[model samples]
Target: MTYTHESKKPTAARREAQKAFREADAKVAMSEYERNQKAFHANRERLRSERLAREAAATAKAAQSESADHVRKKRIVS
Candidate 1:
């Protein structure tokens, strides 16, 4: 008995299955990328807000100290 050689071309069903698998894989990858991007932006925004709060506190402290100094100088000169 002689066996037939394998065909070089894939069957239509196999091609359809491969295409579906590739599309699913790409969809999963895109969702993962979006998740990572959202996390990154959230972290960046948190850091920015924290920095601004610290700067505001520092500015308020400096202004308070400067005003206190002015009051002390007036009492001393009188």
Candidate 2:
């Protein structure tokens, strides 16, 4: 019959090294998440600003056309 040997328990140094590796991995993952969140917010703000600028331009164009029409009508009447 063949006998099987048990595996040795992990040493203190090996355990500490594993813990450090885990901490480093977690730190990297957290920083990556924060970076992605910041980029998302920046893009969202840019889109909002663009939409507001377009609305303001459209309003100005409408006002200018209305004023021009009013001037033409007044000249004809006079």
Candidate 3:
């Protein structure tokens, strides 16, 4: 058998290519958004605070387990 100097290059994966395209599109959209908000830094801060407050509220609510009694009963039976 003859020896080869190099291996063939692999084709790009379709899914990976699609993901890269999506990331590039997101960057373009964000730049446009920043341009539009150049005069709205205060609004951005307010919106960020509101989003953080909402997130904290949701997380606190999620931390309160409603099925503690059920879990204890199941453990006892097991």
Give all TM-scores, in the order shown. Answer: 0.77, 0.66, 0.37
Ranking of predictions according to lDDT: 2, 1, 3
lDDT of 1 at 29: 100
Give the candidate number with the greatest TM-score.
1
lDDT score for candidate 1 against the true structure: 0.99
Q: Give each model's whole-structure lDDT.
A: 0.99, 0.99, 0.84
Residues 1-78, model 2: lDDT tens digits? 999999999999999999999999999999999999999999999999999999999999999999999999999999
In model 3, state the lDDT of residue 77. 100
On a 0 to 1 TM-score scale, where does candidate 3 land against the true structure?
A: 0.37
RMSD to the hidden true structure, all candidates: 4.7, 3.9, 18.2
Q: Looking at candidate 3, what is the lDDT of residue 15? A: 66
Candidate ranking under TM-score, highest first, comes to 1, 2, 3
Pitting candidate 1 against candidate 3, the one with the higher lDDT is 1
- For model 1, the superposed segments whose C-alpha errors exceed 4 Å read 1-7
Off by over 4 Å in 3: 1-39, 66-78
Colliding pairs, model 1 = none
